[model samples]
Target: MKILHLLRLGAFVAADKRLERKEIDLRKLEKEYEEEDDMELEDLDMWDERKPKQGMDTRKLDGRDHITTWSEAKKGQQLGMYVNTVPGLSEVELKNLFDLWQMNMINCCNFELTFLPLEEERMLVLLPDGKHLKDFGTMLRQDKNCLTFVVENTHMLCGGHPEWDPKRPGKNVEAMEKWDQYHKDKKIEDTKKKVEGWKESIPVENKDEL
Candidate 1:
């Protein structure tokens, strides 16, 4: 009877210990979730502080806000991304840079980014010419989806052989001009056809009504 009593006590102790362990694990999980929520809230506040006000044309390019993605690194790191220039710079300057950049690197989506080996962790902007970009730099690490520029301080600016997409055209000033002219002609033709349709649709007022 004493042995059976001891065995029952042992089983009760084991069950109580397991319950205590499960409670501790649940508390740890809850704490982790709370920490994550706090981090997200901090991020939102930081973004609010850094973000520019609406209607700031200079801050925006081609009706889109200057897209800046933050680094997910434990320590702060440079960040960069590729984007097509829908309407970049003044029309003349845009064309000039486009031509120059195309000559150097095969044009992808209007522009390709290149990083420089800057010893200092300050921002490095990739421009068509060696001119400095105001607030941009290379991110130390990136996810697989991103296209990156291999930085070399010795090489010239915009030095990148980015991944290729066959559908885009290379540097062709004549072709662009032709394309612009074609669009203009099409617009004029479309307007003329609309006007003719309107004229035909208009019922002639009876002479008696006049």
Candidate 2:
């Protein structure tokens, strides 16, 4: 009977040791998990730091460095307008009429005229101010030589320059491709890290079961 008691005590001591070792292992795992969480937070902070701040301009990110928003004209200058000529008017006739009209109109003294090479029926007129542009539009609506006109302010009209032709390929295509590849590589790296961490978290004894 004494031998049996000694054997039982030995079993209990072995069980106790196993329990203590398991507890120690659990504590180590918890510490490692906390450390991984801290590392993830630091990575997130670093990524956030690389992003554009709120209300910050992001034109450079998208390769729109050549584009600029239209700003208000200064006191003495004015934004330009596109004028459409009468459908039947020849280029020479339109030019002659524009020259005569511009020379005669006292309000257009401070204005400048530019002829775009696109179409003979179209020209750009730069008036002195908003008030002058309004008056010019009113006069143009009454004139027989004019068809229609538009103020060149919006993105569609302003961006229709020959340099920004839609038929041409975008200048930033390669940059965009690089940006996409960068994101893909980062995603792959993150996935690999997650898989490795999951593998490390599994116990060696339980690996055979998986």
**Residue-wise lDDT of candidate 1 within 1-210, one digit each (tens)?**
434544665577678865553434444444455465554443432224433322323422322111221111211222332322322245454445435544444333343445432322122434442211222222111112122222322111121214222233121234446789999999999999987787777678633343
Instruction: Evaluate model 2: give its lDDT.
Output: 0.51
After TM-score superposition, the amount by which residue 22's alpha carbon in candidate 1 deviates from its true location, in angstroms, is: 99
Note the Cα lDDT for every prediction shown.
0.36, 0.51
Worst 10 residues of 2 by lDDT: 66-75
Question: Which residue pairs collide, candidate 2?
Answer: none
Q: Taking the candidates one at a time, how many backbone clashes does each contain?
A: 1, 0
Off by over 4 Å in 1: 1-169, 206-210
lDDT of 2 by residue, 32-149 (tens): 5556555444333212443332232344222332222222222224457777665677778877867765764565445544445347677777654433544454455456676556
TM-score against truth, every candidate: 0.21, 0.33
